[model samples]
Target: MMEPETRESLIARLPDHADTTAWLEFVQLYEPLIYGIGRRHGLQPTDATDLVQEVLLAVAQSIERFKPDQQRGRFRSWLFGVARNHSLNKLRSLRGQPQPAGGSEAFKQLDQVAAPTSLEQEFTTAFRRRAFRWAARRVRQSVQPTTWEAFSRTAVDCQSAGDVAEDLGVEIGSVYLARSRVMSRLKRLVQEVSGDGFEAIEGELR
Candidate 1:
């Protein structure tokens, strides 16, 4: 029962500087996913770190302007736009001819105009992994050590079930059983975080 606030409510509260709870939620949900996207797109570690800060700043400035469209995604689109914009600037800057864009207008324009293309896949992948990590962290602490290791070694580390069983001093059947149990719980947590499209994400979490 490690339920967290939904991203929509998290976004709703992000604008209030006084809401430390909301900001904490934002950091927990976003910082890693945004930073991971930056790295996967070929940014250096330092650049990825800067991308997180830059994206946050951009969001803080533009949060009020966000309008959720029934035909569109809310934060996913805005975040993808903001992250893409900053990431491109960093990449171009590395090449010595960066295009300058700033303020809420830059973000607003991108959010309004950018269709789910190019960076959209990156956004989705990073999002699932974020959900995975977020759920796994919570699940890990709540589960028994052997059970966690069974799931970790098999599902995460990709070790063979027999090997994991031997390493953990359990039967091979127990290994698969542990994995299934952990996976079931993990899926529930991920579904809560993702809110929809769990079918698409189900296979990827493994």
Candidate 2:
């Protein structure tokens, strides 16, 4: 989970039009999740890209009006709602349009879709995957090459610690220690990226 201070710092910067750096950071962190949601809902590649821009524009326009209420939800939840609505709008727009008679089954299914639950699940899964990948990248760069190799072999590649130690010319104990350190750092990075609403993802990672 993200610390309260960290969540607030990010929330505070999201609505400021002059905060280009903050906006850029926001885009980098969220664009994949948003874009993935569109694609998962069966949008064409170009249409999904267009939907991404539309959703982001909606966020920029409406962010100033968002007042965080603990009773209501977190900023991330609210952001997801915006993306969901925009995606549904895009899907609805395509419902009655002509398709090449033999369109993909996935594309046809979009016409009858009414609920967002399935797409929301996809978004959650994508978010978790992207968050871990982002954190892993950061952790890899900060750790020693040997430490990262040990962690990767044991934790990521599912290799035996004993074998990894032999390959890395380190003691078995060192491999365990390296894996522990990397896991600890990864947890911190996941929380930093995901905020307090990460219980589900964190549970999966553990």
Candidate 3:
């Protein structure tokens, strides 16, 4: 099995155009979250798709200069800022609208008109949901079908343990054990996925 990557080492590989594995990994992880961000920010399907391409292109071009703030978080912090900027850019280019800002002007315009505090709060919530979904898919593949069903029905679907046990034809104690084991595994995988950003959203990741 391929060893899992941490955020720092993963970002280091991004600037290498020859590193297709790294690039594909990066896209698989962040594209959905950024696409969801665009949709939640009122973008249409086409616009959201364009926004994903735009943000991904922007990061690929600029990642050589990407710096993680020690006082802040890591690449995700910079990524979300870029996504928010380009998302606003896309919003302003709809029919009957002026051209969206570009270059350094985009940053200036974002500062001038964006309500970042609220928008970022919303984006962070969106990020958590996306992270959990990613973690669910990853963890499920590594565990038995019955184990995942137990956890999914109880923790995700809000079903009672007794009911899940009856339906799965397992003892109640097995349901309880599966729920505990799967949830614990999911939480660890989520921490790997979220990295530096995990602590900020621990309450919501559940």
Which candidate should be chosen as best, given TM-score against the real structure?
Answer: 2
lDDT of 3 by residue, 49-168 (tens): 999999999998998887664425456667888898788877666634443443334334434653766767666677667777777887899989999999889987999999999999
Sort the candidates on TM-score, descending order.
Answer: 2, 3, 1
User: Mind sharing the TM-score for model 2?
Assistant: 0.75
Between candidates 1 and 3, the lDDT winner: 3
CA error at residue 98 for candidate 3, angstroms: 9.4
What is the lDDT, from 0 to 100, of the residue 73 in candidate 2? 61
Off by over 4 Å in 3: 1-22, 36-48, 70-73, 88-114, 158-163, 196-202
Residue-level lDDT tens digits of model 1 in 1-206: 32233555446776787888767767888888788766655666777899999998888887777776532565676688778778767765665434244332332332354354855866777677777777789899998999999998998789999989998898999999999999988778776666544455655655
Model 3 Cα shift for residue 133 (angstroms): 0.6
What lDDT score belongs to each candidate, Candidate 1 first? 0.72, 0.76, 0.74
Task: Please provide TM-scores, in order, for all candidate models, with all chains considered together.
Answer: 0.58, 0.75, 0.67
Error of 2 at 74 (Å): 3.3
Whole-model lDDT for model 1 versus the true structure? 0.72
Instruction: Give one clash count per candidate, in the order shown.
Output: 0, 1, 0
Instruction: Tell me the deviation in Å of residue 83 in model 2.
Output: 1.8
Highest-scoring model, lDDT: 2
Model 2 misplacement above 4 A: 1-12, 16-22, 68-71, 93-111, 196-199, 202-206
- Model 2 has a clash total of 1
